[model samples]
Target: MNYTPWDLVLDAGFLSALLIVGILLRARFKMVQAMMLPASIIAGGLGLALGPHALNVIPFSDQFGSYAGIINGVVFASLPFAGSFSFRGKLHGARKMWAYSVSTYVLQWGLGLLFAIIILGQFFDLPDGFGLLLAAGFVGGFGTAAAVGSSMEAAGWADASTLGFTSATIGVLVGVVGGLALARWGVKKGHAKLATSLAEIPQDMRTGLVPVVSKREPIGHGTTSEGTVDPLTLHIGIVAVVTAAGYGVGLGIEALWGVKVPLFATAFLTGMAMRLLLDLTPARKYVDGTTVKSISGTATDLLVAVGIASIVPSIVMSYALPLALLLAFGVVYCVLIFRFLTPRIFKDGWLERGLFTWGWATGAVATGLALLKVVDPKSKSGTIEEFGIAYVGFSPVEILMAIVAPFAIIAGLSGQFIVATIVLGIGLIFVALMGGGRADAGNRANSFSNVAP
Candidate 1:
């Protein structure tokens, strides 16, 4: 618990070294690029190999495990600053995407709880809310892994963060490695509408380098004069303010209610209030969405690397057998969910989009997009565009699951939560398959719901 400034500096140096190495591998190796492996994953992987959990060479600070939860606060805090969530018009395609995504998301959580209570809990000595790790890592990624792990620790599960990160790491591997093989099968089956073969991918993409011709737009616009305040600094300041407010709110709630809350949720609520206050003044115009988003990405990258590097190997090994079984169920179940639900949800680009969703279900959205790039190289399927619109609506549901599930487990309401999630997922599926009409209804006979969100 006692440390100096030098401890912080060394940890930063080690993490930065691992990140740079990951970047270099992605840039220099065609195989790495082909798998669409983000530098964060590569960095996290290497960090684990070199840190105390494995070789004990990096000399990371005792505080390393805590960084992910701290940085993840920024990710959540910046959410509302980016702007309102809307679906534009009822693009029927967006409905299907929302429906498909929510159905799977809820079901995954429900199934995870079921596995924890009915199966794993019966066989192994597990902590409360142990089953929720599947969706926490697989669907939530390292961002949620850190937050969920932190929350569980507060609720008396000390090793939850390590297990969550480990689950997320495995999910990413399955997404990247298994996804490529699935892509090949899609192409061979003639279901991939655009790309014919994996070998046809362009050179720049294969090396993780964009050409000069592709660098057409600036990442962000400057609204403030540099003498007064830098634009990036303004965005970062906003994010920091939200993170701090969330932490204060968290402490206040704990004092009043006697239960710890999820930091990400509190940060998000704080950001929402801040965003509204900014909108009342001219300050809203200066809150650059792009710059704030960039800061989030940067923090997320560090969070992933640290999350993996800080895993406690002895704890992981203690529960290794049951843990492996849970992850194996996660991998196969995600694929099965995609196969069964996709055709019912998407009429066009089913194969390409389904494969993309599978990657997302397993781990990261970037991994899903990578699979999409390979299967629909031309971007002709419009999967990403539809998902963008769909996400506007689906996001709150994701936040709800993240906040509610573990608390339910700790409160001994796992059965009720699991049943609610399963029922919600099934109901959403029906809403996807049947319907009312909202889009083009005046012009035609059917509503958007008649056909799908």
Candidate 2:
């Protein structure tokens, strides 16, 4: 059957209806608010339960899953222009933050592989590249899950996306819920600073509306007059061009070398080149990084809903036990990084910083931001500021990990790749320790309860 634009429009209509309902539920239900669930997840869950998989009521097409791959290409490719993701924030705790952030990223890649090799593969029949799913899904969230899952599928793993999305779904839930638990624990232990109680988090965080003028933030600056070209359209056009060009490059590689390259990597590389070229020209003035990032976020919200709704129930069921074990191990590993690792890595604001990293290290950057907002609503903890500066070092290594791991596993270099992650993780830990943070920072803060908020 031909996929008409009308089909897309219809599917979008269904998802949009679900999104509206989800937003209403979030706004009206205190339980949903207490859980801090994103509207997209709620929308996706409704889509999943009501669509083809369960009740077959909504009539979403078979084309649902592919949207995640296509849209995530935009999400990741837009990173090069993420002005707010920042390479210019204050450098107060930048070194220590970089070490912890980079290490968490690298080590998750390694640990996921180690899980496959040491335990999961020995007992069950799985794809050789199967281990990458844990790290891909849990560490980087849905966008990276889509990228890595798509890459692994291209490498001959058939059930990759289903498993990867499953990991991501669980990751976000645990990262948020467990993160809040950790925050409370931190407060009881006298480690928390400003976030004394989760109940005290602003009501507006639960409802996505800006109730007053003072609470509103600009979406982005208009660089072009609407009479000529809308700024939003212009930004989307730029992202589309970059993503399409990257897709073309990927096709070119496959035609020449008989190899399938992941579109996300190619897209990021293309975005980087385009950003550089624009930087050298006067055209840079017309491009707004924040606006481009907004486009990415828009794509992400849709992709999350679509991705969850498209999960192959049988595939997930078949791999259920292995999924459970892998996720359990991954969750424990990430929690330890938050509990034992990052606290020692951050000299000050360990409670807040560690909690944020726990969210990011397991989920996505947004998860970190969500958790951070609850704790440091005014953004006083300096976590994101440090992250902005540290992101300069973080981006390349992250892209490299996404590029290398699947191919390495396919080539049977899993052992060597695992070793490399260990070495990198150890090196990053040493860097964090040497970067001016006290090794005992986690245990030193016992009087935080006495401090005034």
Candidate 3:
């Protein structure tokens, strides 16, 4: 195909049209909706149709090669600005917060890895070193998958990169699936359950957690009107700082530890670290609601759009059945497991946290956000705060996982990948143990209060 700059421009237009079609279908068609159709998977399918791996309609060229990259940078760069969603005072509930974070992180990551090993590993012909990279990509999302994938390629394990990319591509699919399913769950069960507890929330807690919807507009009124200091500006600026700072910090950590990590992970960690510092100081005000919502929402939309457009269809087709099965089973298993075990093993906020973590582990920050929105639109404070912190924390984990995956493969530990998964599970359980007491206390208090009496 003879191509020119105009062709590249056309590609973008094609993708945009496809996205609109996809979104519309999501809105109108139940079978193709976000939860049922699997947004990423559908997007990916469209990409396959448009991308060179299939019809070659969106063939890669110098002009379009970096198109996806530009979109990614735009999406990611907006993160820090969105960092302000979570409420400040909520973190003060020290023991409970700690318990929730530790337990959720452990279980989410652990279960993800275990599932990868037991299910995905059995079907996909993953090379040894790349197994972890593949796992991280599918389990940890794109940043981790790419970070480790690139490392594998650099270390002369190019085959691992192939697997990693393939896995990451599928992981995004899983993310959409998991996120949408969770949203359905939240709307059906989680929402009502949470609302009951929220109705009786302490006045003080409600004060901290209630979304201070601008009184300037009536309920359901869209976007704050013009001339009001655009909260998006603050969020965009903060996100820039967070991304740069994160890269810098991750570089420093790599230099000190003599280990490479995922830049996204580093950026995420850096943002979280700054969040902690700001929370400690009087600077918490720097992160406000508008900034958080704008940054997070915009970045997520961009990421999802770019991600769907970028997955070369040929790659997806190469591993079609396995990837399909991985997503289908993973989504089914995760929802069921969390549904049953969450109530039994953990209580209240921990269940929500676990659900959110699972979404992040399977997908990315956007998935988490969508799920949280369904879980508690009113308590923007708790949901946003948790998301902001989790987004940052997830960064380093991705980088480290990505870079180390290839080595694991070369060492022939592919068969024993379950060991690493087991360790992750144990860690989650350990955190749950620490937080279980506080969660029980909170649950009791919530239950006895009859929801706001």
Rate residue 236 of model 3 by lDDT: 60
- Best to worst by TM-score, what's the order? 1, 2, 3
Tens-digit lDDT track of model 1 for 1-453:
687888888889888988889888989987787777778888888888888778987778877777788888888998887757555664455676788788888988889878877889888988868888899999888887887788888888889999999988888988888888888888898878678889776665676667677664566789899999888887888899999999999999999997788788799899988888988998788888887777888888898888888888898999899889888888878878767667656654578778888889988888898788888776666677667767888888887777888778778898899899999999988887763332321221133233232
Model 3 error, position 291 (Å): 5.4
Task: Spell out the clash pairs found in candidate 2.
Answer: none
RMSD of model 2 against the true structure: 4.1
Could you tell me which 10 consecutive residues in candidate 2 have the lowest summed lDDT?
444-453
Locate the minimum summed-lDDT window of 10 residues in model 3: 201-210
Which stretches in model 1 have alpha-carbon errors above 4 Å? 87-93, 435-453
User: Candidate 2 on 22-120: residue-level lDDT in tens?
Assistant: 899988998898878888989988998998888999988778778888888898778888763244433333567777788888888888878877899
The Cα local distance difference test for each model comes to 0.81, 0.81, 0.51
Candidate 3, which segments miss by more than 4 Å at Cα? 1-8, 28-31, 34-44, 57-125, 133-138, 156-300, 317-341, 348-358, 368-421, 434-453
TM-score (C-alpha, index-matched) for candidate 1: 0.93
Which candidate do you rate higher for TM-score, 2 or 3? 2
